[model samples]
Target: MPTDVTYPILNAQRATELLEIAKSYDNDTAFPAAELKEIGVLLSQVIGDDKFVGSAEDVAPTADLLNAFMLLLICQEPTSPAAAQSALHIASLGALAGNPAITSRGFRLASRYYDALQDSEKAWAYAKKAAQAGDDAQLIKLQNIAEQKRAAEEALAAQQAQAAEAEETAELEPEEPEERERTGTLEEQLNELRDRLEIAKRENVKEHSEEFVDINRQVQLAAFSEEDSLPASPVGVAPNPSTALAKALSILLESAVGALWACPSFATRSHVANKSNEILRKYHLSPEYATLPAGMLARFYADAAGNNTDTTGETAADFYGLAAKEYSRSGNEARELEMLLRKVEVFLIDNDRDEAHDILASRYVNALKYTELPIAARWTVLFSETLRTEAENMFKSTQVLMDFLGRHPIASARSPLDFNALAEVFELLGDRYTSANDAVTAREKYRVAYELFNTANNQEALAALAKKA
Candidate 1:
């Protein structure tokens, strides 16, 4: 069949082959732009003819192929303005063939080219079209640029009006000599009053500064006294007499033994010292009672000294010290050790690792003594073992969980379960499993854990875990 060859119409077969080739080379950097452009030109030419009308019914697929070809050409010749414009034109044609993304991209490319050429009106027009095509970000940027230009113009007009008003005012300003003299007199009087006010302010500040300095010095002295005088008590012991007296001296010292387990303020310290002195005046103070554990009497002295001050000067060490004392005083050794473990946790949070280790060691030794106490004894052993394991592992995996939760706080907030923490644990486990070449088990475990995480309503984590699995 020597048919009429007036136009080159790529029939269905040739079109399919071209489409396959275009798809294959679409994302390949090694693909030639000339080849992709040729394909686009041939497709365009075929599309314009009535011969390929029936085949063009598969327009969506052809459009995708054409879009891919245009994208490849653009990528290869990105710096060439002519190539960019051609790609944009092809994308627009492909859009008619049912490719909305291609249409949106075409608008974006047109806007970018117009912007580079400094054609604001054209750039704005294309940007608006892109926005209409679902490019919200580009639309917002263009709107902001238009708004900025409008604001600049308004500002310039306002400045011109202001200058005109100033010139008019200056022309009229010299007409009233007596009024100007009166205004000058009022201004001078205002300046004189300001000078006096400044002098008074300086004097007031100087007086207040001296008072503040004295108060600060007293606070420091009280802090030092409390620190030096307090004797170290094992976890759960009540403060001894010397510690009580030292605590009594510091207006800033709060009793770790108090209900709130906090320190007293400087004001309270003064009141208590006065009350103690008054008590001494009423009777003969025995020197031996000074060494005795002051008990309720020490607290009363501090209370009187605080004078109902609201400030509680409790530091982290004071809280840990108090917790330790409370634990030591407990009747049940197992419960006491558990409480001491909590104190160790507090010490760790405070970054006092040495103190934490000391508490752990002491509690571990004491827990061994409570082996006779059934449930409590069992708990003691479990807690001790847990603590030892955590220490040995350096809590690295737990730390990873904490960090993950911190970063993806919204995921934690939305989920009933701690998805971020669980995901992190699974991630670490997956890595370990993969390293050991247990792919089958790792895959199953990862899938199950990922499902759990997915159920926790964290899509991003689920996606990440799914990818890993």
Candidate 2:
């Protein structure tokens, strides 16, 4: 039944004829190949089409005609992917024109198709839409199930809220849980990530809480004479009684002076510098009493005028290098990684995610093994920033990066990747293949993504991919 597509697709009579033939399929259960071609041509014509500016010469199919196609599709191949896809496109055309009939049938078709695939979440979505169109009993029943699921989800949310409140209020040790030592299989880790990625996307990871940022900012950085983060004393302090005593004295002085003098006063700059220098110099004279103190200050400026705004990003980049230095020097890997992550966070704020990623990808790849929930969460934030921001340019490499991250390795813990995040990754991969015209690979990715979460927006993409086979 394939027509000579050489018949000008833009010809008004051609569209009208195809619409008439499609609607009169009283005997057929499936559309003939020619009719499918006509339908496809219409879809192609409408892709990125300018909105209909109704005038005397408007040749496009009307809303009523689109609605008729929806009904025709439902009757012809209600459960087929192709028909559902066709219905989705045609129904959208009607909905744009505020046609109730087309909208109703479209939802009904979608609900039926998803239900056939045994995907309750998606089926429930369209069924709710169908019910909203009118008071259909079947639609109402399906809507009720969707409502019950929503209620259950809400209840789960409340429980999680309560648990979070408890955790926040609890007096807890800073160490990770004992179960963190157990790392599971790759499959298990992938499943964990799949679920996590879904939820993260649902909540929109782009807009997550900066709880770690606040924590890092508020943390008192360990001040050792060897720690380059703070202006250190010349003699490095070791784990000795005298060194410990010196560390204690330094902490006391920092709380009293260093913390207070975070913002250097112009009038007192020279005085404080002289005092600090003399204090450190005294350590050389009196070897027993080291004067290095606890540090909680960000000494950004070299002079009181604060002339260096770090406009070239060298200063930010140096912080990353110092963090690396601290990481190599400290035996406590967790603390050092946290300190490094804080620097990366600042890099992100400075709109330097590329630098942040480079530091993380190269210097801190080992941090991925960190089993602490808080630490894993930090990596998740970092990955989210880098992967999402660089997604368009580095999609292939982004996939490799995320894949290498594997799991958080915390026992019975959620994945580092949120469910939506993974779905998005796959979706993006699908797009990459599609752009390359690798239909087979693109369709496989699309199907997996669609199965993970059925989105109305991906309908045409899924359809287009399916048609290639």
Q: lDDT: which candidate is best?
A: 2
In candidate 2, what are the lDDT values of residues 262-323, reduced to their tens digit? 32322232233333334433343332332331122123111211221233335444444443
Error of 1 at 151 (Å): 24
Q: TM per model?
A: 0.31, 0.32
Q: Model 1's lDDT to the true fold?
A: 0.45
Q: lDDT tens digits, residues 139-161, model 1? A: 44565565567668866796576
List the candidate 1 regions with Cα displacement exceeding 4 Å.
1-30, 37-41, 47-62, 94-102, 108-128, 134-216, 222-230, 239-250, 253-469
lDDT of each candidate versus the true structure: 0.45, 0.46
Give per-residue lDDT, candidate 2, residue 158.
66
Off by over 4 Å in 2: 1-60, 63-324, 347-350, 387-406, 409-411, 414-469
Task: State the weakest 10-residue window (summed lDDT) of model 1.
Answer: 174-183
Model 1 quality (TM-score): 0.31
Compared to the true structure, candidate 2 yields what TM-score? 0.32
Every model's Cα RMSD, please?
Answer: 21.2, 20.5
